[model samples]
Target: MGSSHQTVIVTFNQPGASFGQDAVAALEDRLVGAIEAAQAGEFDGNLIDCGEVRLFAFGPDASDLFAAMEPHLRAFPARPAHATLRIGNTEQRVEL
Candidate 1:
């Protein structure tokens, strides 16, 4: 959290990932970039916390937040190139 914000949690929803060094690294990089971009200059003291990134494509994890966020996530500059992001009008299908 910074000046006006409270907290920032980074999430990389790997529906059912085949955990591996390369896979983890890719997710890490993508998540970190998303967090950085979300800052939007509003907060400089962003804190990292541990949590799970529920897959936002379908099923129970999806919500208003996911619905609204997919589009924005697609716009993120460092989005994982090996992930299938059904974000907004852009459908970026990447494989790891």
Candidate 2:
């Protein structure tokens, strides 16, 4: 038996100009934890790496990946101007 891997990329839009540095940092930290927490249960996957603007993870498929990410997306303090979820070559813009 073999396992299939798909890349999941989460790109967050820039914060509003009024957001303070401290606030941005705090939000980033929370977002990191939320993103990491998404890897649980049957959807468990590897969080390969991340940056200030994006997160990269590998999972079995887009459906599981998105399902795991739903909560965090809903909890975001401010709706991003735009967000995107990319699984391999397929891309979907996430609206909150």
- Give the number of the best model, judged by TM-score: 2
Score each candidate by Cα lDDT. Answer: 0.34, 0.50
Query: How many residue pairs collide in each prediction?
Result: 0, 0
lDDT of 1 by residue, 42-83 (tens): 212222223223232222122222333344455533323233
- Residue 14 miss distance in model 2 (angstroms): 3.2
Per-residue CA lDDT of model 2 for 4-37, tens digit only, reads: 6664455445544443445545645654565557
TM-score of each: 0.27, 0.49
Q: Give the top-scoring candidate (lDDT).
A: 2
Off by over 4 Å in 1: 1-17, 40-96
Candidate 2 deviant stretches above 4 angstroms: 1-3, 16-52, 81-83
